[model samples]
Target chain A: MAIIKRYRALIILSIILLGLSLISPERGTQALSLTSASLIDMFSLLPPILVLVGLIDQWVDKQVLIKFMGDDSKFLGVIIALLLGGLAAGPLYIAFPIAITLLKKGANIRYVVFFLGVWTTAKLPIVLFEVAAFGWKYTLIHVSVGLIFFYLVGVFFEKRFDPNTLLKEDITSNE
Target chain B: MSQSIFLYGLIAILTGLSWFKDRQKTKKALMKAKNILVKLAPELLAILLFVGLSLSILTPETISSLIGERSGVIGVFIASFIGTFAMLPSFVVFPLADTLVSNGAGLVQVSAFIATLVSVGFASLPMERRIFGKEFTYMRNLSAMLMAFIFSFIIWVVLPWL
Candidate 1:
């Protein structure tokens, strides 16, 4: 868990770059050019946001978050997790820590999966970019269908995988 | 763009605060940044150059020929898998998908590929290992891939009617 947490940033950064590289060599170059600029751009948003997130991390503590996100009976936690996940911006790397934090706090596996699934699949900015690049029709088809698919996947994964345990294992191993 | 300026300013302030609070910690943080840059810059440049060469060398006809005609279910699957592996940004994929569609590519192929390109990927594995830890990242990606496949299938079936 310690190692996992420690190396998290490096891993996420590398994955993002890797994704860029696979886009044919020409697109890769453009990605590289954009990476630094994007980093600076992300930095602008991240620092302020991190300050807030960090504060939340510290203040909310793990127990409350867990309880808030863990309560499964009403599916309240699941809904909250999905909403947060759906609304989150940036890349998977940016989302991981927050997810981990929530996990430590006691968010359920279903919620985590929903959060993560949505976070990766749904982004208003990215959606807008897609729409602008493609067309409204394409964007509509993709997002509406994609959301339903993601939700179902989240539900399925939750049933199949023990997200809490997986996260717990990560944390314990890191420790 | 504006975000970059704000971030640089914030980082500057934070670094300054850390310096005043604890010089040693500040120095260590600076070293971490340097380390990341050192490891990152060369690889970034190399990848960019490689992409440039590949794009320049490969004819559009070749790309279209390879991806355009394969528009059936198999084609959609192939394109989505390839796109997932490729990871082209939405901006680039849009024009390319448009071109392919205009040329001869099926809507299913184009849509599926575009979705997969953004939503799922293997190229991101290394970074996923680093940031998300190996198991969690892989699981997440696997889930994404499965979902991408399903989404593409839905588009394949539905979009034509629309």
Candidate 2:
């Protein structure tokens, strides 16, 4: 009951969206339907992946990851963070719980920043797709530029926002 | 065979290192993942049904009308921005993009749209907030959108020359 109350808004919104999809889908709006379906598909992947990530998070000790992603140094930590993020498989949704867990484990904000950036920006599988579709040269150009830009953007945001002040959820939740 | 062995050895070393740090944590995380999978399996099936039905219903012509155009940079810009709203997996988008490219859409525009589709879309907005918090979410998205446009332009200008 309490859980239901906690996520009432989400539950309501999801229900509304599902209902809308079921009935009276807009006409000539193939874009709308396709997007809606894609959203549902994406959401479908989220729960299981997130649950797995959440469980891993709950059990994993933070000290080791903390050392890896600590505030003590920026360069090595950000590099490792970006590599881990880029190498990671699964949807961006799957990555979030792991990132949040790392945050709880004491990873620095900048590390998280880089991970999020690369996780979204430089997916290895997607890169391979680009390579196959476009040429290796084109793919390389896009990914190399993208990685540099992702890293720079991540650092910029991390410095701009003192995550401690901006992210309030960190205050309440340990998960 | 030799290269494969080296790769395996590297992976073994990495796994060993992770195990040394926290075997229990990884084990527990995997267990939690199992539970989550069980819970979400039904939803996943439903979502797949939705995707298949929606895609099946819509024709390529419909998709083309919206984003496909010969107007060099402008069409690319529209497609990339619109991609921020449209959510589809890379696999699905690829075939569609190939079709678009074959039809009339430019390479750079498709590339830009693909980049935006993955990086800065509305699809993951809820999860982004849940995990990274809202500030990170907003900033990352805004940056991705800007970069998508810039990269699209780069691809357009450069592809012609190359």
Fnat across every predicted model, in order = 0.13, 0.24
> In model 2, what is chain B's TM-score?
0.65
B52-153 in candidate 2: lDDT tens per residue? 343544456655665665656777777776577565565556667777777766777777777787677564565466546677788888888877887787
lDDT of 1: 0.58
Q: Interface RMSD of candidate 1?
A: 7.3
The lDDT per prediction is: 0.58, 0.62
Off by over 4 Å in 1: A1-53, A73-75, A133-137, A163-165, A168-175, B2-63, B88-104, B130-135
Model 2's DockQ? 0.25
Q: What is the lDDT of residue A118 in candidate 2?
A: 77
Query: Model 2, residue A57: displacement in angstroms?
Result: 3.1
The residue-by-residue lDDT of candidate 2 on A1-175, one tens digit each, is 9566445445554564556556745532443555466655455445444544544465456676666887775677877877877766555555666676666677777777678667766667666666677777777767766777777886787678775554456412324
A142-175 per-residue lDDT for model 1 (tens digits): 7777667766766666676665445544321212
